[model samples]
Target: MDVSVFEVIGPIMIGPSSSHTAGAAKLARIAKDIVNASFNRVTFGLHGSFAMTYKGHGTDRALVAGVLGLYEDDEAIADSFELAKQQGLEYEFYEINLENVHENTVKITFLLEDGSNYYVIGSSIGGGQIIITNMNGFQTEFTAQYSTIMMKHYDRYGIVSEVSAILANSHINIATMRLNRNARGEEAFCIIDTDDIVPYDVKECIEQLDGVIQVQVINVND
Candidate 1:
C-alpha cells in the first residue's frame, strides 16, 4: 500500500485522534459528495472504538462538521453540532456492533429531500485515512484517494464499454474500476477511479449513454 506524507507524519487537522476525528470527517465528507443532493437528516451507526469513545474524542463533532462540508483542519469542527443545527442538518448517532470490520467504523444513513435514502459504511483506518466499505446495498470498496466516479445503472452488455470508451476519448486514464450487480439483468453499480480529473462534460456524456441511471463524482482536489 502506498502511504502518503499525511499518513506517516500525520495530517494537519483539528483532532484529538486522527482515526476518530480527521478520518471521520473525511469519510462523512466523501459520503456527502456521493449523494450529490440535499439531505435533511443523517443517521450515524458507530461501531467498536468509535462507539466507545466518540464523544470524548470529538468524533461526533468531526462527523457533523464534515457533513456540513468543513475541511478537517477547519476550526469550525469544534462547534459542528451547533453549526449543523443552524444549517438545517439533523443528525443522530447510535452505537452498534458490525461484523468482520475494522475497529473504527461508522455507518452513515442519509435521508434525502426527495424522500429517498442512501447509506455508506466506512472505516477510519488510522492516521486520517479512510476506506468506504459499502455504498447503498452494494458491497463496494474504495478509498477515495483519487478523483473517483461512481454510478448505478441497469445491468446490460456494452454499458461498461461505452462508459470506458467515453473516458478514453476524453483522455482520462482509469486507475481502477469495479463492477457489481445483484443479479443478471438487474441494477448494477460501477466505480471508476481515474488518475486524472474527469471533466464535467465527460460525465454528462456518460450520463447520456443508455442504461446509466445515476452518476456522482468526487474530485479530490476540490
Candidate 2:
C-alpha cells in the first residue's frame, strides 16, 4: 500500500519533530494499552535523536503524559510531569543504545500497580507514524493503524487455527498476522491486525482457548 499524503504530512500534534515528540507519546500510549493496568512506575530509554533532543522537543513530557492516558495532540502534555506526580505515577528517563534501530527510538519498561510489568521497543519513523519493533524480547513490527490482538500462548500446534477460526467466525478480516517465539514449542507471541474491531467477547473466547496464556486487544483510536 502506498503511504497516504496525510500520513507523510503528519497529524495534529504539539511537536518540534513528529518523530521525537508525537511518536514518543504514541509509543507510550501503546505500552499503556499493553500493560492495561494502573500505573506504578515507568522508565524510558531514549536512543539517538530521542536521547539528544528529548528535553528541548518535549519528548520526555510527551511520553509521561501518554502513560497517564493523554493523546499526542493533547495540550496537557507540557505539564506531564506535574500530572504524573498528581496521579502518583513515578517515572524516569535515560539514554540508551539500541543497536541497528532508527535514530528516533525508545525502549520503555512499565511497572503496574497490580505488580505486572511490560517492556516494549518503538521507533518514530517521522510524520507521527511509529512502529513497535519488540515486545517482551520478541522481535516484531507493527504500526498501530488497525485494531490489533496480541496473544501469548504455548508454541504448540492448533493455537493459530483456533484463534483464526474464532476471528473468521466473528466476521473479522485479518489484515496481517505475525508470530514469534522464544524457542520451538515454548512461549510464543502472536500479533493479529484486523480490518475491523474485534469485540471484547471475542477476546474472551480466545483467552479461554487451552494454550492461550493472555490476550490484549488494542483498538486503533487514531
Candidate 3:
C-alpha cells in the first residue's frame, strides 16, 4: 500500500499525543476549510477515546483551535475557548455512538452564518494520521495529503469524460478518483486527488463544465 507525505512526515503540532491532539486539530481545520465561511455554531460529537480522554489529552482545545483556523503548533490553542467566546462562536460537545469507527473518531457539524450546515466524520488513525470518512451525509473518503477536488454534479453521461479531458488538457495528473451516488439520474459526488497542484484555472474550467453544480478544492498545504 502507498502512503502520503503527511503520513510519513506527521502533522506539525505541539503535542504529547498525535492521534488525540494533532489529528483532532486537522479534522477541524479541514472541516472549516470545506465550509468556507465563519461559523455561527458548532457541535463536536466525540466518540470512544475522544469522549473519554479528550479533555485530559487536550483534544477538546485542539478541535476548537482548528475551528478557529489555528494550526497544530499555535500556542494560542490553550486559550481557544475564551477566544471563541470573544468571537461569538457558540460550541458544544456531545458523546455519541458512531458504529464501526476508530476509537479516535469525531463527528463535527458546522452551522455557518449563511444558515448552511456541513457534517464531517473523521478519525485519527494514530501516528498523526487522519482520514475523513463522510461529508455532508455522503459516504466518501478524504485524506488531505495531495491537492483534492470534490464536486457535486447531476448524475449524467459525459460529465466524467469531460472533466477528465479538461484535466488532461491542463496536464493535471489524477492520483486517484472515486464517484459515489444514490442512484441513476440523481446528485453525484466525485473526489479527485491529484499529483500536482490544481490551479485556479483548472477549477474554473471544471466549474464551467455542464452538469457541475458545486466544486471544492483542498490544497495540499491546507
Query: What are the lDDT figures for the candidates, one per model?
Result: 0.92, 0.90, 0.89
- Candidate 2, residues 100-217, lDDT tens digits: the string is 9999999999986778777889998888889999987888888998999999999998999999999999999999999999999999999999999989999999999999999999
What does candidate 3's lDDT look like per residue over 81-161, in tens digits?
999999999999999999998999999999987888888999988767779888887788888878999999999999999
Instruction: Write the residue-wise lDDT of candidate 1 on 141-187 in tens digits.
Output: 89988899998999999999999899999999999999999999999
List the candidates' TM-scores in order. Answer: 0.97, 0.95, 0.94
Give me the candidate number with maximum TM-score.
1
TM-score computed on alpha carbons, candidate 3: 0.94
Residue-level lDDT for 153 in candidate 3: 94
Identify the superior model by TM-score, candidate 1 or candidate 2: 1
For candidate 3, give the lDDT of residue 216: 90
**Candidate 2 deviant stretches above 4 angstroms:** 1-3, 114-116
- How displaced is residue 149 in candidate 2, in Å? 0.5
Single out the weakest 10-residue window by summed lDDT for candidate 2: 30-39
How would you order the candidates by lDDT, starting with the best? 1, 2, 3
Give candidate 3 regions above 4 Å deviation. 1-10
Q: State candidate 2's TM-score.
A: 0.95
The collision pairs in model 1 are none
Model 1 scores a TM of 0.97
Error of 2 at 111 (Å): 2.0
